[model samples]
Target: MRQSPALRILAGTALALLLGVSFTQAASSTKAAAPESSESFDYGTVDSFAGAFLAARTAEADRDYPNAIQFYKKALDFSPNELELQQRLMIALFMNGDFDEGAKLAKLLEKDPAVERVTSVALSFQAIRDGSYAKAMKSLKYEGPNDLDRLMNELLTAWTKVGEGKGKEALKQLQDLKGPSWYSIFTNYNIGAIASVVGDEDGARKAFTETVTDKNGGATAPDTYARAVMALATLEANAGNKQKALDALSAGDELITNFAPFKALRDEIEAGRKPKPVIETAAQGAAGVLFSIGGALNRDGAEDTVMLYLQFSRALDKEAADTLILLGGIAEKAGQPNKAIEFYRQVPETSPMRRISELQLGLTLAETGKVDEARAHLQKLIASDPKDVRSYLAYGSVLSDAKDYAAMAANYDKAVEVIGPAPTRNHWSVFFQRGIAYERLKKWDKAEPDFNKALELNPDQPQVLNYLGYSWVDMNRNLQQGLDMIKKAVELRPDDGYIVDSLGWAYYRMGRFDEAVTELERAIELKAGDATINDHLGDAYWRVGRKLEATFQWKRALASEPEEAQVPAIQAKIEKGLPPIEADAAKVNAEPAAEPKKDDKKT
Candidate 1:
């Protein structure tokens, strides 16, 4: 809230706390992991400074931090005193986890106010890592990039007090802390953690209760809120209040559906196991201070700053599983799947997050085009625990990415068997995914009932509605009901281009050419340059006699690179046009498709 892209990030820093933004939020990211173009571009061949600078910028945009760092160093070598170049290099270094180099550069730039927010943070992290708590606080001076930055500084400054063994002072600072109402969850949570670290059990419990009960702030930042619940529950468990700990976890579950860490903790407590307190030392408390604000800034376009904060957080507490996992997610978002793999590999095997990290590692491997390796990894994971729906679902996803629908369907079948036919609301996705697999294999009878079952479990799910409705319309059955379902899906996800395209395509199937054209245009607007959507628009244009524009659209579709199997048909449409609009029993060969998703989207 109160921040710029950079200013907002610097101002409002919090931790991913390993509680992570909801997995649901992570699934909704706009930037999907994409394969960065790896054409052999030799930076050494670039003779000019401008050429090197441009190369650095391009690599940075593609999230190729290693190359970006190299190119930027080359650019700075050519123009050593360029202030902006130094600033950019510092950020690139931090994002790549080159903290020593970043620290050196921070010293070089610390006197310049323009880069103060980042430089101050870098310097403070260096001091903290060196165990110079007094120096760390002294280095943490610059404050105003925005309210978020100032608030983060306030929290970090308080943690520095804890580092100096001034625990009571840190608690007092938090008690008097004030900012946006959103700050309450982080503020109170950290107060509790600090108190817990210093052996003030009653004080810790009080602050944590304040955090867990702050539903409004918790709703605003659920990941931070989740961390608060875990902290409070851990405190209770350590104090021998097992039932209280379980109750807290149950409440957290109700707030955050299917969150793995909470479940992991809840199971431990249920089995008469005690969870250690979340914050055990001054440094861990300080790391939470950074994570509390840093993690809140994990949105699109702020990866650079989030990376900086998280790296610094890790420097404070090397065993911070949440910090490491979040860094992996950021790398994935930045289109650096290999870099993500490195972070995932760094997560301690003993941490509760190790399982999730391994799953992510397998997924990231698939993103790097190691499909076979990914399959073997996830398959072994599934074999490790047949009763784990998560393992099966993850395995099925890898197969789906490979377009091995037969295997995907089989994966779900095994999941269904393990689940014992009593599909609950959480199992809706299993049924839905299975239906899609069967649909791809042209087993309509099998696919239909599964789709129906998914809807029965979670009616109003937009993806299910769009797919089933569009299929019915394409087959010329249940025409009105299909159209209504598609329309409802559109209303539910008005901004989703794929659902909109399904509605438009259904209209084309019904021979409502003009209506088809209108809906297709809207779909085109939502998802520009999509080959399938462009092709559909072209077909609608031809049906409505916009012949010239129709040819333009077909050409556009071809340029966007339709699937290789569809290339020949698209070229023929451009050259000879669509077959005369005629009634035929033979269906058009475009297999029914639900909206194709960008993998691992995070919000």
Candidate 2:
């Protein structure tokens, strides 16, 4: 083991002690022989000090702090200038909680750098506890072992100020630190608490936001963000924005589930009462932690971080509009439609981001089969902005999804009317959608022109090509041209299951069963579990004389309920089996396979 500098000092003292002992004996003899006025000290003092030092060491070894302190103090009194003895005494006194004596001894021996640096910090903390603010502050000013130690002293100073009922002053001291560390944010939150106590709502809000939003600000915890949210809510409530306040408070409640401050604030808000001052104060403290972490987590994609943020956000703010919207998206991604709805509902109708929030909310609601509510929100959006092409398009899209051809066509017309003469890709989408609405309604005359217009506007758009080609094939008209269009679509979107299915279906319609089988098999690879793709493959297989395989594929497709509109038709097909192909008809007229024995059941 390496020898410490102090240990080296002790080791070198033994030789010096030998010389000193001989000199002291000679001086004492000379004084005793020739001097009458001056008295010589005996070796008794040295023996007594040595005895005390041994007693202190024995006590320290036994972990008896009280006995160690007494023995060390007696040794120090006998040999006051012995640095090592004084050091031991100070340590033992501190260990015994006799900080007053320890601090005094440490100061008296301040020339020792270690004593000055380390002991001063301990002394300062003790001074604060002893109600000597000035002395604590003075002790804190001395240099220390590390930054953490220095920070501890600084924190003690702040505590002293707080004890003196100067909370604002104490907060100011903490707030003055600008370092981007955990401690810095913690200090800012402390400042917020002071500001709140002084009725400085604006100051509190600013501090809270700084802790929460600033990427490098000191605050860093979910609870901190919750506090910031609650603080903001209180400010809004005080300013008469009742709904906004409720939203903010509710959101905070959701974020800070375990914190009492958020719950207290929530209860007050719910009861139409003002938050108590202490609630604000405590929340300010939590805000420091919450904002510091929440801001970072907001961008971190780790599931754990996101989940932590989610849980914390839920605790602090129940109706946090922005957080709710974000959480809603996360919930939807996690396949929790109900949870998503709960979050999306927090976004206010008057919010500038309402359109986006409402759109997501409507979609999630529709996923959960709350179609009426989804449509109502869509209608509200349309009513508010009749010329908003997005609202019209969304409403029309939803209607089309429900297979409500008449309503979808009406919405598509309004979308087209508002988007007249616009030379954009969106215009092409509008035309294409309208054509689909017409086609679904079986208005072939109306569908044809719009489809042609869509093709002209967005040349070679694969979806449009597939739709037009599939329509021609379905009607058994222009088979060659329909096949050509579908082949082009297949080339453009080889992996698109719907387009691939259309290409295969077109081939089947033209009685090119081999080509149909190839495309349908490829479609199944691209879109496994797609009911339509499975159904198309089954038809192609039957046309190619794969009767048993066709039956299996058809059963799989029938089991897959793709959407509400397709469910009934697919179920009906499952009950009745697929339409007879030319190959199947030939087999029926030819011969059947040999019947199995009664004991040899089908595997």
Candidate 3:
């Protein structure tokens, strides 16, 4: 999905060709001049091509992307030597997701001596996207002096070595390129990634810290800082430095308050996934080149190193408001709820995403038992942004948790009022949450209507299916429909022990005792500690006439603290004669089949 610069060039070339064709058509018709004589296309084609190309530009300005793309392609067809058109086409291809074709064109365009350094840099990116790191490095040889490409090339080349699993080689390459440059922060981060790849935790830790500290004041200093902090956190965690890991996690959480670029990296690390290998301090470098060179490292699943790098990235820039919101998210993911709240509070009242962050942080705080504080935050966000539906939803959840049923309903109503009509998934959650509150308040009529509404908005959501089914069963009404609903729920959540148990109970209620045993056994296998499932299995065994086995299961169930009133019935069952059980001769003879895992009790 991430388009590389190469694809951009291809798209640009395609568009330029379209523009050139249009130019030639117009010129040939009006000027009435030339017939082809085996020579290369007439120089007059540039005039026509340039005219049509300009018109295409206007079309692009009007948001007519397809039209623009066509005209640009025509222009290029007339004047293949047009560097500007080629560059534009490439940009278009990347934007349009035609990376493969774009990359091919980029390689051809980069061979042109007329292309500028910036254009060549773009071509380098194309090579990276094409999964040709060696080619990207090769293209950089043509890059002009005193430009950003040299540093970028060095960083990418080193990363390529790392991806090839030659960590020592990568380190040496990186060290060779280390010096005063606009890419210092980025270069250092590459060093850290390389160190971590080679299992040099101490070196990686030091490198990451230096990069994040921003002592060099490089353009990408902030990004490097954030990346370094995050990398260090993950490294500490991986090395069992729990305390330091926690501290680094805390710092990374604080950094997102002002740096948005690093947010995704922070998230990936927090999720126990590796961040993409990035040249942490990127003032400007070829896109996709780093990805290509570090493709192997990226796929190496170095989650710990990536996490540290992400944390460092989180601290890179401190002036952007979006950055702070990113920090809030990182904090929440890293299990620092209080810090998440602190970051969320950094969003000013007028910011659109402020309400969103507030809602998320409030819910997180509430879950962490800071209920009052969470509620206050939600109320504040709602007060400032009364039209925001998410804030209302968060408020309702908080009120529901606090057992304030009336307030919960009011908040949900406010959410519905603000959101008007929307898609099913978006509309259903509020209704479902409100329905739960109504059910808790013992207002069944109100709750049923809301549940029905939720189902109408998003049909067959498993949670709704299960709740409605279980409620009907508990009420001893609509037994057949309840079974159908629970069956549907089970299909949706096949691995859920609780849902499976409900199905078993429904079969038992239908007096299909044999059928009940099958599902009950599966439920027990899924949830070995479930008391209700154990008892249900015992009862089903009894009804199936497996008297001895039934009594034994009942005794086992009783021993596991069965309900007080049920103990007497179990005692009576133990005293009564039991039906015969089939002998497991294989187990008695120490057969190999006896080695089946206990949970495999349910085929």
Highest lDDT: give the candidate number: 1
Model 2, residue 540: C-alpha shift (Å): 1.4
Please list the residue runs of candidate 3 whose C-alpha ends up more than 4 Å from where it truly belongs after superposition. Answer: 1-306, 318-352, 420-425, 527-603
CA lDDT of each candidate? 0.78, 0.59, 0.57
**TM-score of each model, in listed order:** 0.90, 0.45, 0.42
- Looking at model 1, which ten-residue stretch has the lowest summed lDDT? 14-23
Which is better, 2 or 3, measured by TM-score?
Answer: 2
What candidate 1 gets wrong by more than 4 Å, as runs, is 1-41, 46-48, 142-145, 584-590, 599-603
Give the per-residue lDDT digits (tens) of candidate 2, residues 451-531: 888899888887778788788876776878878888898899787877787888777777788998998898888878877
Give the alpha carbon lDDT tens digit for every residue of 96-160 in model 1.
77888988999999987667777787888788777899998988775454566667777788878
Better of 1 and 3 by lDDT: 1
Q: Model 2 RMSD to the real structure?
A: 25.5
lDDT measured at residue 221 in model 1 versus the true structure, 0 to 100: 63
- Per-residue C-alpha lDDT of model 3 across residues 235-257, encoded as one tens digit per residue: 77567565665566456555434
Ranking by lDDT: 1, 2, 3
> What C-alpha lDDT does candidate 3 achieve relative to the native structure?
0.57
